[model samples]
Structure formats: C-alpha cells, structure tokens
Target: MPTAVYAGTPVTVTEEGFYLDPDQWREDMAPEIARDAGIDVLTDRHWQVIMHMRKEFAGKGTGPTVRALGRTSGVSIKELYLLFPKGPAKLAARIAGIPKPRGCI
Candidate 1:
C-alpha cells in the first residue's frame, strides 16, 4: 500500500493507484484526482457519473463496469468516453475514489 495526497489529505492507494480505503475519500479530493486522470474540469455530467459510481460502490462493494455505467449512469457509453476518455470506467472510478470496476481490463 502507498499513500498520495489529494486535496492535501493523505490517502492510501494500491500499486495501480486505486484507493485502498474508499472510506478515506473526500468530495473535495475529486477535482485533483480527476485532473490527474486528465480531466481538466468536472462538469455536471461528470458529477452525475461520479455520484452514480460512488453510490454503486457503497451499495455493491465494487464500482460499476463501463457497460453497467452506460445502462445506469444516465450517460451514454459514447458520452462516458467523451467525459472520462481513454478508460472511462477506470478513470471515473479513480476520480470517484472507488476501486477500479471489476473486469475493466
């Protein structure tokens, strides 16, 4: 396990950079993490997906996959790519401070 600072708070993460403890996450950390994932800004659409990801993770114990996100996030698969780009689910999960969705890779 390793720690990185997000929004000036230290957070433990895995070797792949996924947070080790989702409970340690803070809403304020989202912007910085999203920036690191190459998203310059988190629009309302972005927050919609982020909130869905967090809710899914809290209830299911794991983040949603890209396919699942497309169906449930109210954002289309094409739009998901447009928003998160390059690995939508993985990047969104990172920004949402949840573990990478199962079966992403």
Candidate 2:
C-alpha cells in the first residue's frame, strides 16, 4: 500500500490517492491534502463541504455524490466548484482523507 506523508506522518492511500482508512485521517492532514489538490487554502465554506462529506460518508459508508453534496451541504454547487474546482466531491474527499466516492472516477 502506498502512503502519503501528511504533516510528517505516514498515511495509507489508495492508488488513486485517497486515504485507505478514514480513521487514519487527522484534521491537520487537510491542509497538506488541499495543497496537493491545488486548493490554496481551506476556508469555512470548504470546511462546510468537508465536514458534510465526512459525516455523510461515515453514515453511508461511501462519499457523497456531487448532487447529494449540492442538495444537502450548506454550500451551493457553484460555490463548491469554485472552492474545489473541477471535481468537488473527489477533491473534497481527497482533502477530507476519505475514500474516493463510489460515483467518482
């Protein structure tokens, strides 16, 4: 298994670069992951999506879809795109230290 160095700690990651275990994730990993994902900084709005994704993934056993994120997360779809850029769900999931969404590539 490949591991990513986050804040100097090794974190297991899938071939696609998502975390292998959500439990292994730490809040400090977010910024490093965000930097790797090209997100300059994670704002409160970004946290809104990240928290929602983590919450929903824990309950559902998978990351949420972009549509689901748009529907329930406090942030809007357009804003999500602006915050996460090209692929909100995938990017946010990566930063949140969760697995790639079932619906994502």
Candidate 3:
C-alpha cells in the first residue's frame, strides 16, 4: 500500500486501490501532487490533457492511445514528447491518479 497526505488528510492505497477525497482535488494543487507521485512536471496545458484523459478513461475503462490523447489535448505528438520524456503512458497515468502501469512498477 502507498499513502499520501493532502491538506492534513491521509489518502491510503490498499489491495482494493487508492482512495482520495474529491474535495482535496484542486486543479492548482494536483500537478504538484502528481509530480510527487513520480510524474514529470506539468503545465496548465498538461493539466487540461490529463483531466481529459481521466474523463475519457472513466467513460471507457481503458487508457487512450497516444494519437487519440494528442488529438484530445490539442498537442502534437512531438510537443507531448518534449513535455513527457517518458511518454504519455507513464506521465498521463500518474497525472490521472491511476495506478502506475504494470511495466512502471
């Protein structure tokens, strides 16, 4: 299990998975927290992309392909790569608050 504290509240992850307080999820603060979780730095553009990806995954139950993600984010694949050297799969997963992908673990 992994845990992180936000605003004096503790969030814990167990075999069942992570639990976070929705109230604690402020857009301004999320990028910092995401970085602490091993993500690369995020800009406002990245936040827009990450949030969109999260919504998409919630609706579909699977992550998007890089091409789709780039289209949704309005960023080119080249731009995305410059921002996320490890690629979308790793950085986006962290920003979306999803568990690290299998290979990352």
Against the unseen true structure, what C-alpha lDDT does each candidate score? 0.91, 0.91, 0.60
1 or 3, which is superior by lDDT? Answer: 1
Query: RMSD per prediction, one decimal?
Result: 1.5, 1.6, 4.7
Write model 3 residue lDDT over 1-105, tens digit each, in one string. Answer: 566664455665434332333333445555665666555567777777778766766676655667777777687788777666666655665556554444411
Evaluate model 1: give its TM-score: 0.94
lDDT of each residue in 15-45, candidate 1, tens digit only: 7789978898999999999887778899999
Assess the local accuracy of residue 11 in candidate 3 as a C-alpha lDDT between 0 and 100: 60
Full candidate order by lDDT, most accurate first: 2, 1, 3
Superior by TM-score: candidate 1 or candidate 2: 2
| Cand. 3 Cα-lDDT | 0.60
Candidate 1 residue pairs in backbone clash:
none
The model with the greatest lDDT is 2
Clashes of 1: 0
Where in model 1 is the C-alpha error above 4 Å? none
